[model samples]
Target: MEDSNGSGRGPTVQDVAARAGVSISAVSRAFTPGASISKKTKERVFDAANALGYTPNLVARSLATHRSGIVGLVMGDIRNPYYPEVVDALSRRLATHGFRTMLTTVWGDITVDDVAPSLVQSRVDGAIIASIADADRLGELLYKNGAAVMLFNRSAATSDKLSSVRCENVEGGRSVANYLLDKGFSRLAYIAGVEHIYTTQEREAGFVGRLMERGVQLFAREHGDYTYKGGFDAALRLATADTRPEAIFCANDITAIGAIDGVRAAGLRVPEDISIVGFDDIELASWPPYGLTTVRQDKAALIESCVDVLVEQIRSGQRTRHIQLVPVSIVERTSVR
Candidate 1:
């Protein structure tokens, strides 16, 4: 046998045994999670492995067990700051629980058709989809294959088949509307994002419903496509109009920031001339320059809840069909009066 298959060549079992002065089986036993091995032998093998800079081959071990210790994460909208926070929290928490994450990016609104193949081919024991729609064909396919799924930052549309963790968007919307109304602003407008997303729908509904209760109506409406540029242009149109709204409620903080700039460009001061409110208290929302008043969602709690459900199913083969709706709170700042 060759002397050793060192570092770059891949640390083979033979190399480990040669360095440790043990049989090939002893090296294998040392790496196995619960295999029976004497403490002295195990220590020697591990010490040799450390000296040789050997990383055990999880793939070969996975082949023996027919299960890869990886969970797939299907997410997109990386452009949004909120989504990255979600990914970071999940990655860190999952690592602590001894599971690896595989990310599969989905552009725009997620569709099962677009994301399913990559996840299935990767053979992930379980998956967490950050953006999912109604329990469609894609949901069915993933279930049929025995891969447990968890939905992140989405509502309970597909709760029958999957675990979901999301924030209370409607409640946040209602609170903002009330805040604006209490501050005594009568002329108000709404800047909506992509119409199809549930977050936008629920938020708009809550705001409108609250306004209707107060016997007031929004002065105007613009579709912001959940984008900075969209909000900027929409703000310009609102500002240039003969009757500009006294306040605007944007679907997200990014749009709210853009609306602020747009209003300033239109020769108006935030909260001084036209108050603005936003949702999702992202890092930038609190910047001295922006100081946007918005709704806050706990990213850490969302990830903990999502990972708890996913790991429960993956490890024990028990199905947990839960739809967890986390609460949101309003964070007051200079943007709103």
Candidate 2:
């Protein structure tokens, strides 16, 4: 019940090591999974630890090994349902690999700079950034702080120093354009997310670029900022215009659902009056009310790639850059004619 120093304090690693007839480092290795130690030594350490009721201090062990066994997950705008699903899958995957998740949300007035210091101070072995306005700055900061950086659902265009896992956004956009054009819709409109973000730019470029190649022009364009209210407002604007588009392609599913409501509120029938399409086939997209046709990104593949890249960097102490682009597919539903 007492430490090696015999000051009446609870048992410490020193007490366990002394009783086990081993060095302090040996005791640490016994507790660390995958550490190099023989079974007999580990059994002795466990028996001594049990007799003395000693438990290794994780914080102290982290200081010695320089591994916090934690991964920071920086997300943006949890209001969108897509991110919650990403969080769930990513957390479970990381747990299976013996690492815990430390979450931080950057939305509204909150910026990455505001949260980066805490994540760095916690000594996270690595970080996975789901969304960020300034990826370059955040990647640099985390990299300098000794944390391997991985961008989830983001491209490495802005920050080549970090690894990334994302879907083929440009191709997804092209597929949407092809679907709408194949339906014989001459007048097509587009709803965009943030103007400067890579995802938005790539999706818009692919959609409009394909349309131009087909000798057609975009009838209208609006910024939805990847939010429900933004989508609603943009749709209302398009609905009341002197000339309305026969079809609308939203950058994401949340926006598409909002656009559908706006179209209905404006007394127009979906598919019958104006066909709609969306990207990122979120769970809500398949609902009877929405039935949104969109591009489906493989969430499982993306999370697996992110975890693999980050864990390798942490274990190897090497900063090897990896940029993975998972394929995307079009999901047809009642929203599209």
Best by lDDT: 2
With a 3 Å backbone cut-off (N, CA, C), the pairs that clash in candidate 1 are: none
* lDDT of candidate 1 at residue 181, scale 0 to 100: 93
lDDT of 1: 0.81
Best TM-score among the predictions, by candidate number: 2
Count of clashing residue pairs in every prediction? 0, 0
Model 2 residue 128 CA deviation in Å: 0.6
46-72 per-residue lDDT for model 1 (tens digits): 999998778778889778755566788
Where is model 2 poorest over a 10-residue stretch in terms of lDDT? Answer: 1-10
Deviating ranges (above 4 Å) for candidate 1: 1-48, 108-111, 132-137
Kindly report which residue stretches of model 2 are placed more than 4 angstroms away from their true locations once superposed.
1-56
Tell me the lDDT of model 1 at 189: 97
Look at candidate 1 and tell me the lDDT of residue 80.
70
Give the clashing pairs for model 2: none
| TM-score of each model, in listed order | 0.85, 0.88
